[model samples]
Target: MTITVSNLQPIIAILAGILILIAPRLLNYIVAVYLIVVGLIGLGVLRHFS
Candidate 1:
């Protein structure tokens, strides 16, 4: 199984949103990690074609 771009954004957004909601104090860390992960994936450092 692979993950396509179309399927990636919403999941990431929801997860980040949840984390931010659950721990408002962790927003910075969560956003940083989320951005890094998504950036790597977007840059093709990681690829999932679902």
Candidate 2:
């Protein structure tokens, strides 16, 4: 199975927003991991999406 970039981008943005809003303390870690993972996925460095 695979997930398209267009499909996952918005959801990732929304989840990041919610997490930042609901738990300010986790913003750093959440954003860091999100950026790292998304960067890899976007760059085609990894292909685990499904």
Candidate 3:
């Protein structure tokens, strides 16, 4: 099973949703980190790692 760029966002969203539901206190940090990581990925900074 391969994960493409198209599959990344929804997966992240779903996971974030679950995390937020389980721990409301983590909502802020989770969203901030998620945005940062998504931005980095979009900008190709994390391309090499993938």
Clashes of each: 3, 0, 0
lDDT by residue for model 2 over 1-50, one digit each (tens)?
56677788898889988988999898899888978887887787787662
Q: Candidate 2, which segments miss by more than 4 Å at Cα?
A: 48-50
Task: Tell me the RMSD of model 1 versus the true structure.
Answer: 2.6
Could you tell me every candidate's TM-score relative to the true structure?
0.63, 0.67, 0.73
lDDT of 3 by residue, 1-50 (tens): 77776777788789989989999999999989978877898898999534
- Top-lDDT structure, candidate number: 3
* TM-score, predicted candidate 3 vs. hidden true structure: 0.73
Ranking by lDDT: 3, 2, 1
lDDT of 1 at 17: 90
Error of 1 at 30 (Å): 1.2
By lDDT, is 1 or 3 better? 3
lDDT of prediction 3: 0.83
Against the unseen true structure, what C-alpha lDDT does each candidate score?
0.80, 0.82, 0.83
TM-score of 2: 0.67
